[model samples]
Target chain A: MADTSHGAAPGAESAPGMPQLDFSTFPNQIFWLVVTLVILYLILSRVALPRIATVLAERQGAIQRDLDKAEELKRTAQDAEDAYNKALADARSQASEIVAEAKADIQKDLDKAIAKADAEIAAKAAESEKAIQAIRDSAAKSVAEVAQTATADIVNAVMPNAADAKSIKAAVTARLKG
Target chain B: MATEEAGNGFNIHPMDQFEIKSLFGGGPIEWYSFTNATLWMGFAILAVVLLLVVGTRKRAIVPSRSQSVAEMMYGFIHKMIEDVAGKEGLKFFPYIFTLFIFILVSNFLGLLPTSFTTTSHIAVTAMLAMAVFVAVTVLGFYKNGMKFLGLFWVSSAPLALRPILAVIELISYFVRPVSHSIRLAGNVMAGHAVIKVFAGFAGALGVWAALPILSITAVYGLEVLVAGIQAYVFTILTCVYLNDALHPSH
Candidate 1:
């Protein structure tokens, strides 16, 4: 291929030389390179970089906001829990007070009922005692009347001849007295 | 040349791939004429637009695949500049990002079969390195005035050795652009040329073509890694140079 290179001609078009060494193409390559670099720089600086930076910043802000919201919700939950505990404590106290009051009222009612029963028992016992006394007085009077009648009948049977009723009654009374 | 003689049994033009041709038809490569270089550079620009501009059109907080790639490139370059060049260097983020994306996309595009590798050209990489060199030098002087010259003077050295160290530093400083440009172009050009040569061997050794083909595959994979690494190296070097400009103390 080296010998076939069209007879040692200078700057021959058919020569397979290193194109990078070709100084003639430098201006073209450099020019396009500048154009490309400038265009790339403009696009990046003006549009792409700013956009990406903004997106990243916005994402950071969104994350922070979500964290704050979560914290607030947790606080609210804590507050709700505290309130529930307080309400539970208050209800328990109120129930105990109700129970104490009910106990006191029941104790007062029991004392009143016992006092009324005791007074009724006392009145019934007094009435029975008065009736027993009346019965005893009446029995004693009947016994005395029966004794006088038996003594009068016995005297009449034993002494039939003595016929004066006033005299016999006087004699029986005197003998009984003696 | 000896490879050319050895390949006398079969025709192989490995260097032919680097030849610049007019995109339209046969014509002299004029300064403004559209060539394959321009076409591929245009493709690189279109890729940049598609990836950075069009892909991020939604501006989503949770990015899609293409948008994620765009953001990753953005974040990668951003952190690199900040780390190497410090906070004030963030002002030059767009310029550094442009160089990175252009070179990266161009290198990857060149890996496509029959696609031209623009970064493989000394003209292109030299231009890029020269631009960085010129920009950083001007920024150094502008930001520090005459103090920028202190970069070459090693104050930490012994007094007797200072002048010699400064001379060495000065020489190295001037050679930066040359090495920077040549490193990228050389690595890219060599990889592509080797692949082409191996492909030619596959054609010549028809029955035992699998050997060259396998070598080509392995080289191509390494080339893929080189593609990304070269781009990273170029960008980071630019950052280091920019840092020297901004600080210039050590």
Candidate 2:
């Protein structure tokens, strides 16, 4: 390092005043600047900048691809859910229809069974009425016969042949008629 | 420490650090001479290459720390160029990025205990600013032809005042390069000089030098901040000037 140890030289001399204002060193500074700056420009434009740009673009692309995949999966899930709902609705409607048909069939069978019961009861009642009529006739006949026998016995005991049997029979018949 | 003080023992040569001499030996500086300026300038380039090229050699999907840093710088400069200069101006991004990185690296490297601050020199900054000025002027003409001069003419003004406004605009336009160069160089130089002055105080103050040491630390921190800011300012101004070239009427 060339220290400027020598006291400040006169302004007219070789290295005097502000070294910055000194024109002698201007070329050296400018030349290197141009060289260094040009090289830096080349490196930045051609080598460095492109690498950074590529990394950023790659990251962005990866993110976009993942998002698209996720969206597709979400859409598939939604479709499956929609299909399940449709199947569930169909099953509900089918179940109700089967229940309605089963109810109609059971109702018809019940109505048929009730009609058969009513016909059987009517036939049994007719036969029971016929039996009651027969009994009543028999009972009337027995009563008449008994009355005739009693009259004959009484007449015989009281008088031997005085009273006619024909008269007694006719009297009994009139009483019964009255 | 002994060399910093003069015979009087209270002297401080804050400006001595800026002196440039040949690396080989003391002699008259030739146009082709390799000096301390050239050495630090080389270091600046090497730093940029190490960070940008070697760091990104793998080009991994998951970047290492160095790669991320490189990518961040790339993106930042890229966005800055696009934002200030419009999309068309991005064609010049390489040049602008080079300028920014070199200056920024040079400024930070200079913060090293004995390192030279290349950006602090007017010759370097002037060259850069003039390069921008020349390139933009050429690009403006190349793109818009005679219409590029419309940057100077303000059509919205009253007809009588248009010419006066154009003169003022022209003067400002010409002043752009001077201001651009000086802004970076001047900021860097001032910060360095202040630190040097404080360091001198620290030397002279001896046992009670803690005060100047603290001030130096604070000023050094500010200088680091200024270094980055000046680089940003320089690059963004370049973009703005390029924008004017691209859309002269605007």
Task: Look at candidate 1 and give me any clashing residue pairs.
Answer: none
Cα deviation in Å at residue A16, candidate 1? 4.5
Question: Residue-wise lDDT of candidate 1 within B119-172, one digit each (tens)?
Answer: 999989999999999999999999999999999999999999999999999999
Clashes of 1: 0
Output the worst ten-in-a-row residue range by lDDT, candidate 2 chain A.
A1-10
Those runs of model 1 whose alpha carbons end farther than 4 Å from true positions after fitting are: A1-17, A111-178, B2-8
Q: What 10-residue stretch in candidate 1 chain B is worst by lDDT?
A: B1-10
Candidate 2 off by > 4 Å:
A1-17, A109-178, B1-8
For model 2, give the TM-score of chain B: 0.96
The sequence of per-residue lDDT tens digits that candidate 2 reaches over residues A29-83 is 8888888788888888898777778877887798899999999999999999999
